[model samples]
Target: MRQDTEVRTFRDGPSPATRRRVLAGGALAAGLGGVGAAASEARTAEVGGVRHGTVRADGVDVFYREAGRPDAPVFLLLHGFANSSFYFRHLMPRLADRFRLIAPDLPSFGFTVVPDDRGYVYDFASLSRTVGAFVDALGLRRYLLYTFDYGAPVGWDLALAHPERIAGIVSQNGNAYLEGLGEAAWAPLRAYWAKPNAAAVESIRARMTLDGVKAPYFHGVPDPSVIEPESYTLDAAILARPGNADRQVTLKLDYKRNLERYPLIQAYFRERRPKLLAVWGRNDLFFIPPGAEAFRRDIPDARVRFLDTGHFALETNGDDIAREIRDFF
Candidate 1:
């Protein structure tokens, strides 16, 4: 086995020159809009009509992307670290036709506003509670949960808190297994958690740049030209907001709490046996295939698929993932 620190470092990312090239190039063929004008118009005409809103939930102004018809089955999309509801921009448009897609930018991430009073904790437990308040604020009785990366813990906690409210679960590179957090990939964060000194903080912050944000989308893809550079560029700008970096590192250090609850999360899966569909990226270096396969251990009927992509599978296989979700529901 590779030593804990032997995993590759993300410190070295694409330079500014490369990002400038991508933005100026034809790689953004799709742009932020969908395929063609007709398709884009049709997508916008979907039920919820891709509305953006902010609601006061648990003392924070939680920003969310609401699309599809309210009467349709609810599909709650929870994003991961270094990103916000914007992560689901591509998938939301596609699924909005059938399901009620709601993607929120958690506090301290996107446009969501968290007060400086320090009244709330930044750990997963508190974040999970905030998510619960957001769900209840929207009166979501039962909804499909789409969890990715950081979303896994929050969604799982929500399921545990209110089992009757869950319609099903869709996991994309979400981790519920210990083995999913490969040591090499987590070394820096682990170091931070252990020491939490200035040096440790600097180690993790080094990759919080624009290039680091862009790396995940095209990490293992064969064709890097397909993904739009604007995706990460926008996210990087959000992370650069005042005090957001410290909040992110605090969350990263608190991730150990999520791992501690993994057993309870698995117990819920085995006992409650919620319908599960894991659309994973096989090339994901963090949450590896074993984490996706672990779903089968509890829910025998779980549908698991390993895609030919990286952590952000939707960047390359959004259409495929969307189709699978539609069929699964």
Candidate 2:
């Protein structure tokens, strides 16, 4: 049950379990802070063009937007850390015309609620676990996995573990191995995952922004208005929660540790070797083109499109992205 990008730790408040720790002096990141931006775009979710709302999942209620025939090919869309299913709302229906588009609010984001007081472990492991459960709960044993940003790792793990269950994959700006920019969390999290400080913590928080969200979408596109500010706002709000900054810092720290499990991720690709459609924001300031090349290294049949967008490929390239999914299938 993550919105955890790279990190995977801290459940039941704090768990004594197996993990890796990279650097030191990064834990002091208790302080972090957002944009007025535009309101969230109006997204209409319909089932066969019939308006639909939320869907239920075990131990958590998932608010999702779906459309098209249930019998059609299934396309499951997932967003990044601090992002909700809303990013797909604008794109899912159009794709639903050809396939059953399912986009859900992952555990801690969007309309999905988590009691901060109870301390749900929001990390990559939980994300990977719950996504597999979500498929079983919905009786979707076979479907295309659409992943972006943090969704990459979660979906990758799923595809690796259950290759037969995955029909295909839509890789949109999701991290594969250590492909993204070695930013604040990348180094510090890896270096000081177990032991951290506010200074190192502050560096991680500095990267969050509406512009950062929009930058990726602008990569190949000729227009900038395509960016929806509210989506960035949603991401920013999650960081605003009390102790969230620390949680993010801790999680990122954990993600670096999780990085040590790289051999597993790489081996999964070799073992499963599923067809991957790589849709990327070439100009993505975060996970740039070098990262895009990494996908090709593992999956030989990878078909890549460097969109003029950033991490949220569903926004600017929604129509084309959906079409690409159809082509891959």
Give the poorly placed runs of model 2, Cα more than 4 Å off: 1-58, 115-119, 179-195, 207-222, 241-244
Candidate 1's TM-score: 0.83
Q: For this target, which candidate reaches the highest lDDT against the unseen true structure?
A: 1
Q: Tell me the number of clashing residue pairs for each predicted model.
A: 2, 30
Model 2: how far is 200 from its true place, Å?
1.2
lDDT tens readout by residue for model 2, 139-188:
56567788887777778777777777677787787767676563632565
Estimate every model's Cα lDDT from 0 to 1. Answer: 0.76, 0.61
Model 1 lowest lDDT segment of ten: 1-10
lDDT of 1 by residue, 167-221 (tens): 7899999999987887777888778777767887776776688877787777888
Compared with the true structure, model 2 gives a TM-score of 0.75
Deviation (Å) of 128 in candidate 2: 2.0
TM-score, each model?
A: 0.83, 0.75
